[model samples]
Target: MTRLWNDPQEFVDEMVEGFVLANQGYVRRVRGGVTRSTASPEPEVSLVIGGGSGHYPAFAGLVGPGLAHGAAMGNLFASPSSTQVESVVRASDRGRGVLLSYGNYAGDVLNFTAAQDAVRADGIDCRTVLVTDDIFSAAPDSRATRRGIAGDLTVFKTAGAAAAAAYDLDDVERVAILTNDRTRSMGVAFTGCTLPGADEPLFSVPEGRMAIGLGIHGEPGIDETDIPSADGLAELFVEHLLADAEIPEGVDPATARVVPILNGLGSVKTEELFVVFRSLVKRLGERGVTLVDPQVGEFCTSFDMAGASLTLLWLDDELERLWTAPADTPAFRRGVVPTGAGVSASDAPSAAAAAAITDLDAEGQRDDAGADVPDSSAESRQTATRIAGLLRLVSDTVSENAAEWGRLDSVAGDGDHGIGMQRGATAALEAAESAERAGAGARTLLTRAAAAWADRAGGTSGALWGVILRSLASELSDETVPSAGDIVVGAVRGRDSVMSVGGAAVGDKTMIDALVPFTEALDAAVSGGASLADAWQDAADAAERGAESTTGLVARLGRAKTHGDRAAGSPDPGAVSFAALARAVANTLKNDTEEES
Candidate 1:
């Protein structure tokens, strides 16, 4: 449906009014709907950032605290007017100078350049920092001309912080340039957002597919692929970022840390955002990339659409400290600062430190504390190993099934569910294996593995999986022994988290149908004082039955919804898969415990 707006002009005006009103204390609307931070003054330098309006908390939301001094907000999915840019520059001008920073979009470039000239005529010193951080936006040789995405956060944050710290205009511009040099972003969209007064979406992609490198404002993407899991998506984005902004040749991938922004473009839930973040972090870790600081939320949006963008900012000492600095705004706020003895000079972990194998136990398992503990339990290790193996199997199965399922569902629905599920499963397996190999406790292994899986696997299913895993892990983390009762509790919490985040109840044709009963049965068995194996057996059996029951249940959410009555007679694949996984885990646990005894 088109947005309920009186007219395009009125819509833009009203939006600007609301934004300024909402942020009155920290920001003020200058000419052309641009917002400027009241805190910014005539310093050695001035910072200006702007872009289309749809991506909120972006061009404007960042105009406070240690961010942009001023922002030129454009019309919905359109660049701001040149006059607006000029007005913002005048408002932001300190006698010392101004730096115009904006994305590398044609409309933005034209307007911001004109605004720069206008400011120069006014006898104000002004410069520009164009952000071109999207690797897929253009060929490598043409990267300078590529459109900016979420990397704008880093560019502005660094520049704003430098300006706030009283850096000269040239120095501030240099900080912005340095941030861009170390930043890259990539995104994929499953659907497009509609402009405020438009009935149709800004862009379109076939159902069950994703448009990789799609511009935030409905610009055409590089290509469309069957939607991938959060982990797969993370891998895709990370690979591109790493390749485009090659980590220094001598740097250890693991010790190399960066800031990650898992951004939702409206319509995507917080749960999904977490899933993407988890995947991004895990993948980066495996590749020797450490996460120095992370901001996960809807920093930018494209109305109500299903999609996400990943932004990575490789930090030097200066940028990292600036990023870590305290800031407050309506949309974003830094938490309590660490009791630091001053910021560290080196952003990269030392080679000697990196060489040391920290966090491993005597059994060759990694611990959270990064210390090796001997005499770790063999039974726990075996259980972790089995779970890891099962996760791998699940990943392989999902991938194989996704291709087949995608083809089958292509007739009536987007076919990427199969692929999405498979990729998520694969990512989960990798995380599980890694945690287990690190000598994590059984509970820790399951919890971390689930988090890893959910993070990498992107869609609704990925979110669900993430919730389940996180709930389970949280419950199990504090337990020393983790009896069947503990497992039951963890499962119940997982089921609850899934329902809470997804808003789906049992019999909704979502994974909850299987997960709810599975956990309930496990709880009952545990409370009745059944053996761990017995409780697990009952839970697995209940899950299978629950999954089978979904065959007759009409789909309520997700791709199955489009199937209508046809979705009946086929068990929800998510439910079926959940049951299968539970059964495998139960069997493995039983066999392992018996062998140990």
Candidate 2:
């Protein structure tokens, strides 16, 4: 399915307009959507670059005082025309000359070469340097012809420094080429990116498998392999770059140094990136390479692909100095600003000082050492067990109804919601049981259970469940006993928190339909001084009625949005699940209270 866009051309044009507006003070938009550095208007040399959109902070994003002077922006995954490149060159021209630096691709080379001829004819001196550092892009024998990857950052830094230091255009071109030669990068993608107006992904990878050496524009990779653990993936990526860069095969006992860059493609989390970094450092040390000045984060991305790339730039004194130079841009900033030179290692906090300052137990209460701290009260244990039972029921219900829900989602949604809900419910039940066994408080048990559920089951429903439970736990912070009034207050606060965070309401065809009425009825019954059991029964009945009403309403949000009118006459599964949970809570409360009395 194609994506919905006003028009691809207009979309690209408007985006360029916004980018130029945001960077106007620091950089100026030259002809053809190329941005030129405003700080170095008359540098001894100038660097002109160009590339496709979506790979932000690459060609255009690297334009600044200490990077490329100008960049010709292209359409997403499409090359810019020769004329467009020439226009950018003319706009960035200085008396000294201009250097063209770009990835090694046939289309880019052909276009940039034509632009170079045109610029030379206009009496502006210009030269070109191609970056080919992707080891997977070409055979080892033809590595010089490979496409550039994350190593583009190293190339820009080197060339930018050369230009800023008053090197002529030729000198800057040489520096860029040298950096490209010394750098190498490789990446793997678990999933492909989606280009605007394109329903189908730009490329495809088999589920539970990854494409090694995948191109940013959806091109086929060298091989497909079963997905590895984060640590394993890190080792594979590091091995590829190190081999290509020809880091010495044997470890030197003394004076071995290297710089490692761990980059996220787009959608990977910072936590995952750090995990990869930890593994990479361990492997590098084993190889006798001392990591110096490591840069780890999303320096480059391929839209929202779920993957990462590793780039290694062998650092020398000159390269290291240039890499450490003061440079600031929207996405990257680093410099050698001095700090606290006199601070010694002994002045840092000792291990004993870092120990807990309070004698509070995990539940945030005094430990009272040698005194018998009470286990969870019988009422609290019952409440926790009821929650665990409810979660188990929901998990079973979801598994049984998976086929029906999957059929509904097949038409418009991803068909994973049922599975996601089942997984989350299972996790919640497990957490609740564990917390109860540990004698945790009501609030702590609920919070821990919810966090476990959300972390184990990714997606919208998991997040919403986490919010609801977290809000409920927060409301019960000081209450030792949960009366019907306390339940109503917690439910109301939880409902409000979900609405505020998710921007959904009673008629949004979301779980809010059942949740809103359940909380409202509970509040009303409690305010009228009904018994706790009676109030819970009333709220459960209202929740059931609200959930049933959703059968006639068309879904207007989330994956259901694509169903349009077809979603009508079918109750939202989220609302149904919420109603089921409300009823379960009411029944549990009544039975437990009767037993206690």
Candidate 3:
């Protein structure tokens, strides 16, 4: 349990601030995260790596001369928003292009890809290499879908080394991809971790049992067995890693040289890791595998998690050379890194804090207002005010049901859906209210709200909700009144766009399950000449049914997909939240009609 924190929401921010104060020699604070405090002799291809916070040393602690040029830090167990990613990329970009690398989680993929496209629009060359090294997240043939774990160091080291060597964007990307292909990791947990202010851990295992294939974000393991002795546990690791299906392609363990990293998740001590490493190294030697510079300590971590993971990087000549290259970072350091003609920390340029999506004053008053909004007509402004009211209602509804949604998500996910939805919905309402105060139109209000939701929420749901609203906003006109048919068309566009962006189908057990049925029912009702309120109520009812039906289905997408079986008896939190939002909107519409009558 995290005992020391002023506020749970402010934990990550405070941690970053303290980290920079302590390591000013290596890194400087930036808007989204940290960047190097010193400059290289000349611009090399910038290596920007990041993911959620709590995995310290992985992201911010790795930013320095020979590692990451910058890191885009997100909330606890959440991916950073696209706005955050863009900020770090802009600050890190020199004359050379930038290479974005991070774990292969759904939120990170959505946000990072969006940032890549945004920077490219400004004529900056940017590329991405997702770290997919967790062996248990997906089958060997489905490696692309696997999540990254402790093996992140191997890929980051290789890419950063290549960049430090003055490799172009193409070669840097190539080596990063090749490194990801050669790295494999597996993790086990003795107990789950608790987030700050949470009364319980995300998930728990029975006493004397150990979980296998657990994620770093407190996600419950996929399988469990009785805890084994140190030697027995090492045997388990060797047996699984040496299996033919688990080895990297073209690498024969009998004659291959590999770098083995034994990483402590959080609470596991260095002594325990050494104990495990002793048996692990002996087992590998028996099979004729040559171990390279073996590492045993914390690299990537889950806050307070009682667990560890082992990573292997199959080495060839080029990989071996890069793996041993001299580099210095706050966390991982190699042999002496030569001093370059780099600028000192005192002379380096500083960046202003990034504009927050959900801002607050020093006294904790809301500060998401005061932005200048777009122009609108009187009739459209009336609709915008009504939209603001509807958003307020939606925000309240989500807040009321957040705990239940979180419980559902914890069955198979990292259990932050409720927090994310709350953030997105609140930010959306704040943006809509601010837009309405400036006499904006419905389209302008929705557009602002959509951007805020995506930026504040910073997850798969956030990205999807932003897409839904932006698509709907595009169909509305500031000068004309919106009809029921127009709204239905917008909803259809939103639904289709979400399906395309998220790559999920109707039966994938995501929010699409509820969204599809609601859209279809609303369209059918509106086309039959029903009033907007009547049509919406009917659609909301259909959405409720759709959400309930997910309890019998298995998840085929997102974080839940890895533990699909565990999620079989529970409805997807995303689908449930969507249904709840639809019902809330329906109630607001119905109330407005009754008041008018």
Candidate 4:
């Protein structure tokens, strides 16, 4: 359990500040995360790596000369916003391009891709590498769907070392991909972890049982069984990893050198890791596998999860060379690294100005209020005012049912959905009200609301909501009043964007379940010549039915996907929230039409 923190929400920011202060010799504080304090001697590709907080030595601790050039830190178990990722990348990039790498989670994928596109617009060449090496997360054929775990160590090391060797952007990306292909990991947890200020852990195992294939973000595992002996656990890992088809094909276990990393998730003691590794070595030896430079410690971690994972990286010639290359960082180090004294700072000019965080971060994409807002007519401005009021209504509705939604999510997923919804809804309302006061049009007002919500929410749902609103905003014209047909088109665009980014269809037990039906009903009604208010009412009813359907479907994505049977009876929290929001918006439309009549 995490007992020390002022505010749970502010924990990541405070930790980043303190970490930079303590590692001033190695790194400097930046807006998104940390960058190397001392400049590198030669210009090399900046290796930017990041993910959610609670994983120590993974993100900020790895930023230095030979490892990551910068780290974009996020909130606990949530991906950093695109704003943060872009800020850190801008600060880290030198004349050479940048390589962004992280675990292949949904929020991280969306945020990092957004950052990549954002930086590319500024003429900086940037690429991305997603670590997908957890052996038990997905089947052999669906390797891309697997989550990253302790295997992150070898991939990062290979990429960082390749960058340190002054490899060009293409080669750096190639090696990182190669390393990802050769690594595999499997994890189990004896107990779950508690977020700071939370009274309970995200999910718990029975006293004598353990969860298998658990995620780093406190997600309950896919399966549970009675706890076994150290040897049994070691055998379990060996069986899964060695059986993986992706394990470097035709590599002779006798001649092939492997780097075995035994990573303790959090509360698991170092001694226990050593004990498990002891049995692990015997099993590997029996299989004629040669373990080289074996590491046993906490590489990546959950808050206080009593669990550990085993990762195996099969080494080839180039991989072996890069694996042994000189490296240095706050948490990880290899050969000797200079103290940055003799080397002139002119070698690497800093872009820290762009990376500086401010109170404006809370404003998110809304900071661009004066940037590219289209002109709006008086009639459109009136609609914007109505939209602001509707946003407030949605906020109130979400707040009223926040605790209930949270309780439902706790049964299968991390219990943050309700809080995340409340944060987004509240932020959206605030941004909309501000835009209304500023005489903004409907498009600008809703777009700013989307940005504010995504920034404050900070999760998978937050990013999706941003995409939805942005899509809808793009379809709206500020210069003219929108028609019922226009509303249907915008809503359809919003639904498609959510489905595309989230990769969850209607039955995936996500927000798409409600969103798709709502859009479908609206489109049908509009095509049949129904009024906007009447169509919205029908759409809201369809959304309610869609939300109810989720109670019979198992989740296929997000943290809840792995909680087999645990979430069987409850409707997905996302779908439920979307349905409620749809109803609230329907009421607003009805009220608006009545006023006009």
Those runs of model 1 whose alpha carbons end farther than 4 Å from true positions after fitting are 40-44, 244-252, 335-597
The regions of model 3 sitting more than 4 angstroms off are: 338-370
Q: Could you give candidate 3's per-residue lDDT for residues 395-473 as a string of tens digits? A: 9998899778877888899878887888788888888887777777999888888888887777789889999988889
* Highest-scoring model, lDDT: 3
In order, candidate lDDTs are 0.67, 0.67, 0.86, 0.83
TM-scores for the candidates: 0.55, 0.54, 0.93, 0.89
Please, what's the RMSD in Å of model 1?
22.5
Over 4 Å off, model 4 = 244-246, 339-381, 410-414, 475-481, 526-531, 558-567, 588-597
For model 1 the local lDDT of residue 284 reads: 80
Extract clashing residue pairs from model 3: none
Better by lDDT, candidate 3 or 1: 3
Cα lDDT tens digits for candidate 4, 490-564: 888888888887788978889998998899999999999899899999999999999999998988888777664
**lDDT (tens digit, per residue) of candidate 2 on 203-241:** 567889998986665454567899999899988976776
- Estimate the overall C-alpha local distance difference test score of candidate 1: 0.67
Error of 2 at 46 (Å): 0.5
What is residue 335's positional error in candidate 4, in angstroms?
Answer: 2.6
